[model samples]
Target chain A: MPESSLRGALTEAVLYILLALYTPLHGYGIMQKVDELSHGRVNLGAGTLYGAINTLLDKGWIIPLAGEMDSRRKEYVISETGKEIVAMELIRLQELLDNGRVVTGGTV
Target chain B: MKHIVHKAYWDYEKEEQWLNEMSHKGLALEDYSWCRYVFRDAPAGKYIYRIELLDKTGSHYESQKYLKFLEETGIECVAAYMRWAFLRKEASLGPFDLYSDIDSKINYYSKVINFWNIFAAMELVIGTMNVLIGLVNGGRYGGLGFNFFLGLPLIGLGVALVKLGDPLRAKIKRLQQERAVQE
Candidate 1:
């Protein structure tokens, strides 16, 4: 991956997570939302979500909800950084879809 | 009601499976030391177990914080022995793993290798110290090689750990590179 793409890969888990976190959500909640948002095509595993959450936290892309330290169900909301990353990734994804459309031609 | 099982230093997968199997046998893991597993009687197949590895010489603060984080996610951190943590939760839904994707799983493997490196370094140091001490006391105690021999197990453990984790580390690095280009 290019430096940009590496940073903006927006893997299914990552993209869905960023989308889910647009509204503050807990781990399970995010998992559920990812599944629902992808229309049952993607089922975010707990382990995958857990690791992505940690990575996002490390990058300061997400922050835990207030006083969630001791709570069994902690919530996280996307940060400004997360929003920017999502925006950039969406652009890359848009380009991909556009290029695909061009290569296929407007037959239909 | 209880059983003590001795697990090897790098037997995380087997240890996890064993714990889950024990849970199926109505023995829920309550705690564990380096090689000793403590269990409590429970309904068969009631609990799921997972193991998370930490850096061998992990700090108490970091370990506690991570464990607390796991707890917040509804996983019970039942035991901490050296660099490994034993986590469990109700198995009503199915098995719950702590790392699922290739990248995260690679990271998990890397942590194991890192801990092994730490353990290997510590073993090498301890072995060197033991040999040095044994040499110094050669005439006084007539046990010149005993301390060195005593340290052999540590060195062996270090070697075994390296052997255990090095492959995973290499695989992760290669995968990362290939994945980078593919992406």
Candidate 2:
């Protein structure tokens, strides 16, 4: 993909991870949820997910939760702050979707 | 054998120019970032290289640093605020000792500092509680004096926190300034 396209996708990728973490999810789980929600259009790699998780943690939008430790896998959950941000993002997306529907004669 | 590794945040245009400049100096640009230049074949000793960052208006910010180590094989130096590791097959290079020293010092200092910050914050809370309690009792039975004594230790703790972290803070600031100059 083009660099600009990749940059644009990053914002959505971050939101998808936030949405997936509402019930607490691991890295792989978040990737799967993103693909599912996007109808398989967005397939985030492990490296990208790892980078996103660290960035989200640094920004205080996600927190690691206590977990069973059979493997090195860890679980994360969205914080209260993260929930609020996600809600705002959803509203913004809804507006965009509505605009698109109107432009496309409500077919989409 | 000589090896030169350039490290920096990738900027294709500027990097191409930098490569050209290095080529002119007879140094090969193996790798790089926006803020780092690694040069091999430097004489065995400490040497300082200057870095300059230019703004759109043509104004510049600059910094200088010594080549951390140099041996017959390659040179190991650090610029900007980033750490790097490089190897060249042809050259016998000395290990970059600066990173290890800085890392150990940072580890030691951070541990000491985190402990001190928590301890001082706790002391502040405790001291405030003591003073509040003494005031509520109207300073009866020398309570005011006792609270004042308790508060002194908190003040001391705060002072210690500042003293302990000050040097590290300054070092980080210096490093940041150097990085900005290399941008």
Candidate 3:
């Protein structure tokens, strides 16, 4: 894949994370959901998943939902701000899809 | 194999004591040479090593460096910089102070220009009087010649000062307005 197209995957990672946390999920649970949703095409490493969780928490897009089951495990949920951002992203994706359909004569 | 290495040019006695403490904790001293103490099977991540120098004034310097040779190289790792005191010190020096000094100098220049503007009208009056006195004395006193050399440069300098002041004064006023709005 071209380097320029890598940005799309980054955006997809953020969206996938938000989707996985819709019902409040743990770190490993979210990673599993991402892989399942993408049919095993988007497996996230533990380190990468932890780093993403930290970044999302720092940005106020996610928060700890409940107490950890064990010292090594943590649970997280999406915030209201995160929901709004995801909704905005969905609208953007719809617009892109519409444009692509028009430009490709409804083939996309 | 995991290892922790501490680097220092002095404090050999304290380093030895620390090595012994680590040994008691089950972290075997793998090697010690050239101001570095290496340990095997040591827990990785962040750890602080404090060495106290036996000086009258008790001079102290603290350094913070990440020890991540294993993690970076795909091995297990636990490393951290040693703490100076028991408490984590807040960073209160460096770039922050330099930025504040720059802001103060700009503010000072703005005030100096405002002072000059309030005193500028006096120069025209002084220039007129010197020209009049020179004409009245009929060229022997050369008052106009002296004032011309001195007063003209002062006038030019004053004009340059005002020109320089305009932009800085505007910047200061804009900054003040922004702060007022923020408050």
Reference interface contacts recovered per candidate: 0.36, 0.00, 0.00
- Off-target runs (Cα >4 Å) in candidate 2 are A1-10, A67-71, B1-183
lDDT of 2 by residue, A11-59 (tens): 6668888988988877657866877888976666433455577789997
> For all the predictions, what are the DockQ values?
0.42, 0.01, 0.02
lDDT of each: 0.77, 0.53, 0.52
lDDT of 1 by residue, A1-108 (tens): 566545536677788899999999988788768878988666665656776888899989999998987776789999999899889989989998888888889453
Q: A72 in model 3: Cα distance from truth in Å?
A: 2.7
Clashing pairs in 3: B44-B78, B44-B79, B45-B78, B45-B79, B46-B79, B46-B80, B47-B80, B48-B82, B49-B82
Q: What is the lDDT of residue A67 in candidate 2?
A: 54
How does residue A30 of candidate 2 score in lDDT? 81
Clashes of each: 1, 11, 9
True-structure RMSD for candidate 2: 18.8
C-alpha lDDT (0 to 100) for residue A23 of candidate 3: 79
TM-score for all models, in order of appearance: 0.75, 0.34, 0.36
Candidate 3: tens digits of C-alpha lDDT, residues B76-143: 22222232111111122111111112233344445446555654546545655655554656476644
Interface RMSD of each: 3.4, 17.2, 16.5
